[model samples]
Target chain A: MDHYTLLNPLIGGILIGLASLLATVLSGKIPGISGVFGRLLVLATPDPPSVAAATYGVAGKTWRAVFLLGLIGGAALSFALWQSAAIFRPMRPLVVMAIAGLLVGFGTRLGGGCTSGHGVCGVGIGAKDSMAATLIFMATAMVTVFIYNRAIL
Target chain B: MKAGKLFLLLVAGGLFGCGLAISGMTDPARVIGFLDLLGAWDPALLFVMAGAVAVYGLGMLVLRRFASRNLKLPTASSSPIDRRLVIGAAIFGLGWGLGGFCPGPALANLGGLRAEALLFVPAMAIGMLLAQRFFGADS
Candidate 1:
């Protein structure tokens, strides 16, 4: 692999791992972004929460909101300071992104977690379900890519 | 709110975002570039995953040992591999392949004020709401 391909990605992955580990140690909470965001959405809804939502008290909600704000704010701060030129746009249409986003939001909740939660943190912790979920994620994503690129576009 | 915890949270979030940008997760094209197995497949993402998992695995092992020794580390529980997990993961994979933006990167990219993220994030929030409604209040 090229130097760029090897160094940045490897180091970046290490950083992500470290971050997740830190979150676990500091708060005893899994740093699953999808789960955190999903909780917020569920809480925000006007309708009464299910028994599960009721269990997620004000303290948990506060931390989650703080963590999310930190995520966005941190990214913005770094982007502004370092001004990384690596960002890209959607190759697909706006409609595609929207639809995909919806699926991501819904599916992650249903699935219990996303890439960071399942693929990285879940697998690392020796969770059988996470391992299974990760395998399914990679397989289905490949199939989708094949269909989208070869058949559709 | 506890200042220390908040600061750590900020640091963790910062590290995660930096990792996403550095690992090229902020770039959907790069993500799609790897997913296109039939085409010119870039295996860089594999290295990213490997690098991440290796570090996390070591950390977890160490943490578990400490916890076993009476440290206050949080415990982890495993979910079941049932229909919800399978169907949900499948749907997520399809969406990921379709959009090239997962939850983390999508939110991180939104920090840059990307228009696509503006659309994706709100719709994603709505989708979460709808999903909870469908699955019942707790789901």
Candidate 2:
């Protein structure tokens, strides 16, 4: 019974959802992970509207730079606090990680935000859609894992 | 609208990321292990959660101090969750189970991890666009 973190996946999922909810409520914006990046990448386009819009709201580079900074800083800080365990877990080749990354981007866009968008924030706001989405995501994830455990990996 | 606000969003991202990292979320191995159960179930992921939940709960307390007609939001914007949500979630989960990647981690990976992200992130975006188009966000 190693209760080191004193937390489990179930609770972790719930907490993650809750944080998304809180952020959405506080900011008056949904905490959609991909959406945040999409906003960041607006500069990829030379289109005036995208550029203007990006300027109107949070400056694309500024926000994106901060976002990246936060991510890296957070990872590094966590590593510092908890050592390697906190920073990263063993991973496959860069190619494997890259493939996983792209699929997720597609999923977030197709699905509209990541788990945080639906699983946590939408849920907190009492949206029916979030609940359904969260359920599906969890079930699918479980099934996917079950399959991997049995068949693939 | 101004440099200041942009700064805030970045700060928020960093804060959020730091929180995620501190909770041991940056690593897919931990996430996968948690899902493994008998094979490699690590319950430590729970602390990452406890801290987050506590933060949210405390946030509510502090939020009340700033609560007004609009609360923390300049305008109380709300979206009603609906059927499309279920479909979106299912699609998202299918990807997650396949590769333990999510939007947050995906974006964070722009730092590196090229090929995996190139494929997955695009798929995720497609999923989101489909939702906005199909659902016609009302609000």
Best by DockQ: 1
Model 1 C-alpha lDDT per residue in residues B22-126, reported as the tens digit of each score = 777777887888888888997767777888888888998887776666546544564468998898889889889999888988998888999888999988888
| lDDT per residue (tens digit) for residues A1-153 in model 1 | 122456767877898899888877766767788887888765555444573454366766776777777777666765665534245756889999999999988888888888998898888877888889889988888888889988888
> What is the DockQ for all candidates, taken in turn?
0.67, 0.34
- State which docking tier applies to candidate 1: medium
> Which tens-of-lDDT digit does each residue in B1-139 have in candidate 2?
3666555655566566555544455566776666566566766545554444455445554565666756554121244454445555666676676676677665444434445445556655554444444443221
Model 1 bad stretches (over 4 Å): A1-3, A44-55, A81-85, B67-76, B136-139
In candidate 1, residue A87 scores what lDDT? 50
> Which 10 consecutive residues of model 2 chain A have the lowest summed lDDT?
A1-10
Q: Model 2 off-target regions past 4 Å? A: A1-4, A7-26, A42-65, A80-87, A91-99, B45-54, B57-66, B70-83, B109-139
Total clashing pairs for each candidate = 0, 44
